[model samples]
Target: MSRLFRDVEGGPLCPQGSVVCIGAFDGLHLGHRALVRHAVARAQALGVPAVAVSFEPLPREFFGKAAPPPRLTLPRAKVEGLLALGVDHVGLLRFNARLAAISAEQFVREVLIARLQACEVWVGPEFRFGKGRAGDIATLQALGVELGYTADEIAPVLLDSERVSSTRIRAALSAGDFANAARLLGRPYAIGGHVIHGQHLGRTLGFPTANLRFGGKVPALSGIYATRVHGVGARAWPSVSSFGTRPTVDGVEPLLEAHLFDFDGDLYGRRIEVEFVAKLRDEEKFPDLPTLVAQMHRDATEARRLLMNEQQRATA
Candidate 1:
């Protein structure tokens, strides 16, 4: 079992000390994974637990929400990804105004030295933190000398001669290049959340959907897509998905709606992952509900065709 904490005020979560890795870890992409893996290895060598530290709401999202950058993963997914990467402890510090105003020295003294009792601190090449973004690897190393810890930054993970990063993954997704995004991510980009009740508009149009809200964060991609819904059975189910504010329905918040082919089960309150396979088209507003329905039929048909081909290729 992995321990999780949302604040730094608590007493040492790892009293024996830990090898801690800190970053935004928004997508847990290849680079992020490498950093965590390095920390885990260092922890094993030092006989201490490995701790993964990140900020909730992300610093960028906290400072700029009006037109915040698209998020690669939600809070829950981020935590799950960290635990999956073999982190013994996960700390998602709250990133509010108070935390934003904290000094680099204070952050190190309270969070790293006191709460985590870090034996070593690990970060990426481009990592920065503290108030006004003043902290860097140099700052961490300087403080670590007095705090009885070591600090080091891991080299960036490269793919196809390019660095693997959340920004690159977002760009690939925006351009409808799932293959490129997957290559960088080391797997298909997927959104996981619990299903919630919706307006049932899709059901009325003869296409029922399982709805998942994006938790008030901007999604990295917005379009109709050919997808696979996991957590239903032994295998992933083929689906057509839409991720955006439904302009035709006057929706204000971004929602992910996935309609599984030939699936008729209760999904409310069930957690599921929507794995994006390929983008279909951008979301558009129609003049009437009938027009929207017609367009949806076409989208579903195309998604089915693409998914069928993908399955056949996999078998081959």
Candidate 2:
């Protein structure tokens, strides 16, 4: 089991020594995976633990809360992905005013040296941190020399002649290109959360839904999508999902509403993963409830057809 730490002031997460990889890791894209894998390999060679460090609220999000960039993965998904990548320790440092004010030297001395006892560090080619974003690979290397550690940056992972990055993945998703996004992510792009109670509006419209809140973070994609829900049965259930604030209903917060075809069970309070198969259309407001219901009927029909074809192709 991977141990998780949430603050730099905590006791040593890896006392002996750790090979650490540090980044925002918003999406855990192919490039991010390559860097973490390098850290894991180095840790094994050095016979130490592998540690993955990330920041919650991301630096950009903390600074730009009024209009933060769309997030590819939530905090829970990020931790799960890091653990699945074989890290022995995961640190999700809180990115607040105090942390943002720390200088590069202090970050290295306190967090990397004192808390993690890092013997080696790995980062991506474009990684930067510290106040004014002053830290770079060179900065880490310089500090590593004095701090009894080593540092290196990994080359970006490339797919189809383009470098894999969170930005590219977001662009693909926004453009409704799930295949391209999957190639960059090394897996399907999915959102996981516990189903929460809603106003039961979908049920009245003849389309009951399992709703998941976005937790105030900007979502990477917002649309009607063909999806599959996992964690309920022996197989993934086909679904049509809508992610957006319900403008027609005067809704304020972003919510993901998934309507599982032919499913008739309580999903409230259940955790599930909604995997994107294809984007059907952009979220839009209908003039009235009847119009919205009519549009939903068409969406369900199209989503069902797409999902059936997708399953056939997968089995073939």
Candidate 3:
């Protein structure tokens, strides 16, 4: 009955049969949404639950030891995003050494066949899985004949003739091209998480902030951003946010700190989403406290100006 799961060795989750889609699904962007929604439609027609199978500590992340690479979405956000797309169940399979050693055939037999009892399986183009990333659409189709299921690969979603992909989104984010990123993602770029206590350095500097941590994952983008915080009230509150380690304070952990304008409330333990509107500046270390505080004031003023303009245009 649980909507979320994190392991591959569990008992059957969809005993009655299900439609399954598999992907990394880090960003839950247009392509991922399309694949998941398609599988959900198939499940509805078949009167079975829809299951989305993805991996935590994604294969690439696991294998890329030189540098783990940046992540656009974390585990929690990935699950919530998939569920919001109408997937009845989510499998954020733990991708450790054990899971990595299993053959593609073993994966399909254990996860797709035995666990999910999938009657129909869907995936994005060029989808691959299993040890050494050996599985592919051909592998799935061939296995489907032997395992009593059907396999399919959805056409790659495209924008302006280029494939809409997580790679593309990451590039846009790196360039601070959020408008293009939003176009590919099908929504504004935002990160949602429960607020946690920080060093209270912002408060000490007279710019109190609500902080969110990145759970040790490297973020795709970092810097000062003009943003809007959602879920506190009727509307998205105007805010300025910084996503990065506070080098100026000798901080090591990556954190997202938002300073909501003209707002006074406790956000600790409250989950909220911060939507990025524009990149104000890159996070940098200042010489001293006074200089850092002065820059913070300027950054805040710039953020306010940007958000107000955005609000005016939205209402217009």
Candidate 4:
């Protein structure tokens, strides 16, 4: 069973000598996966539990308000994916102002040493932490010696001659390039949320969609997509999704609205997972409701065809 631990302070929970990796792990993309794999391997070799320690309200989100870009994965989805990757435990640390003020030495000494007792630590080459981002691989290595442990930096994972990173993934998603993003993530780009009541405009247009109001940071993409909707998971239902500010409806907040083909029955408050399969088109303001409805029909057709082919390919 995978354990999910939340760290409210700049402290750890596991006992000492545990093998661990630490990072924001926002997307848990291929690069992050490589580091986690290394940590897990080290844990297996040392006969200790493998743990991944990450932060909530990520330091960047808390500190970089001016440049807050959309996140790739929410905490819940990231935790689910990490568990699927065979991680034994996950730590979701709360990154408040006080926790952010801890010095690197104190983070290592009090948290990593006293609480976690980590015998070995894995981090990425560009990873940095502690008060004002003062910590680096070199500092961690030096501290490892004094603290009686080992530290290693994992190199970046690459795809198409570019380093796989959360930034790159977000860019791909914004550009509506699901294939490229999936190549980097080793899975489909997904948005998970609960179904919510909307203005029922889609029903008037012959498409009764399940509107999803996400809980955490939204993704960068805003457009029509060919998607797969999963809930009970018997099979991924073909879907046409629109992610945007709904300008036509005068809606200001972004929403993920998915119209699952051949699906009926109330889904209000039900959790749904929408996986991006292909970008159908960029969102635009239509001159009239009739025009928008026509475009939606075309999008639904394209989404169905793409999903059918994708399912066949998977079966083959």
What TM-score, computed on C-alpha atoms, does each candidate reach? 0.98, 0.98, 0.98, 0.91
Worst 10 residues of 1 by lDDT: 8-17
Tell me the tens digit of each residue's lDDT in model 2 across 1-316. 5788988797777788999999999899899999988899899998999999999989999999889999999999999999998999999999999999999999999999999999998998778889999999999999999989999898878888878889999999999999999999999999999999999999999999999998889999998999999987889999999999988888889999999999999988999999999989998888999998999999999999999999899899
Candidate 4 residue lDDT tens string, 1-316:
5788776444555663688898878778888888888888888888888888888888888887777768877888788877776678888878888889999998888767877788988898688989989999888999999889888888777787878888888888888888888888888888887889999999999999989765546567889999989993588788999998887778777889999998878888989899899998888888889998998999999989988898899889
Full-model lDDT for every candidate? 0.93, 0.92, 0.91, 0.84
Candidate 1 backbone collisions, by pair: none
The parts of candidate 1 lying over 4 Å away from their true place are none
Between candidates 2 and 4, the lDDT winner: 2
TM-score of model 2 vs. true structure: 0.98
- The stretch of ten residues in a row with the least summed lDDT in candidate 4 is 7-16
Candidate 4 has a TM-score of: 0.91
How would you encode candidate 1's per-residue C-alpha lDDT over 82-198 as one tens digit per residue? 999989999999999999999999999999999999989999988888999899999999998888999989887888888888889999999999999988988898999999999
lDDT of 3 at 102: 94
* Residue 254, candidate 1: C-alpha displacement in angstroms: 0.6
Query: What value of lDDT does candidate 2 attain over all alpha carbons?
Result: 0.92
- Candidate 3 residue runs with Cα over 4 Å from true position: none
- Tens-place lDDT per residue, model 3, 1-316, is 4398888877998889999999999888999999999999999999999999998888888898678888999899998888888889999898999999999999999999989999999999888888888999999999999888999999999999989999999999988899999999999989889999988889888989989988788889999999999989998999999999889889898899999999988899999999989999999999899998899899999999988888899899
